[model samples]
Target: MPHVIVKMYPGSSEEQKEKIAQEITNVIIKHTGKPEEAISIAIAEVTEDLWIQEVYDKEISPNKESLYKKPGY
Candidate 1:
C-alpha cells in the first residue's frame, strides 16, 4: 500500500486538493505500477507558524532521513 502525504499551508480549494490527489495518484501509478485503487493520499495543512516545530524539527532535524531534499538540509 502506497500512502501519499502532502504537507503544506492551508488555502487551496477542495477542488484543487482533489486535483492534486488525482495527479499524485497518476504519478504513483506510473512509477510504482500500483493501481489507483490501491493508493491512498492525505493532505496535512500545517500552519506556517508551527511548520518548523512540527515538520522541520520532528521530521527533518531528527537525522534528516524523512526528508529527501530540502533547501539547506
Candidate 2:
C-alpha cells in the first residue's frame, strides 16, 4: 500500500483536489506497481497565515482573482 500526502495552500476546490488525487494515484500505479485499490491519498490545506515560504518569509494568498479571468486573457 502507498500512502501519499499532499500539502497546499487553503482554498482549493473539491474538484481540483479530486483531480490531483487521481493523478497521484495514477503515478503511483505506473511507477511502483501499486494497485489502485491499495493506494491512499490525503490532501492537507494549510491556512494562508500558517503556510509561510521559508525563503520569502511570506504567506501565499489564494489566487482568487485569477479564478474569474478569461481563459485567453
Which lDDT tens digits does candidate 1 get at residues 1-73? 8998889889999999999999999999999998889999999999999998998787768866655776483
Q: How big is the positional error of residue 42 in model 2, measured in Å on the Cα after superposition?
A: 0.4
lDDT assessment of candidate 1: 0.88
| Model 1 alpha-carbon drift over 4 Å, by segment | none
- Which residue runs does candidate 2 get wrong by more than 4 Å? 53-73
TM-score of each: 0.86, 0.67
Q: Report the Cα lDDT for residue 56, model 1.
A: 79
- Poorest lDDT segment (10 consecutive residues) of candidate 1: 64-73
Report model 2's TM-score to 2 decimal places.
Answer: 0.67
Over 1-73, each residue of candidate 2 has an lDDT whose tens digit, in order, gives 8897777777789999999999999999999997999999999887666655521133223443544332232
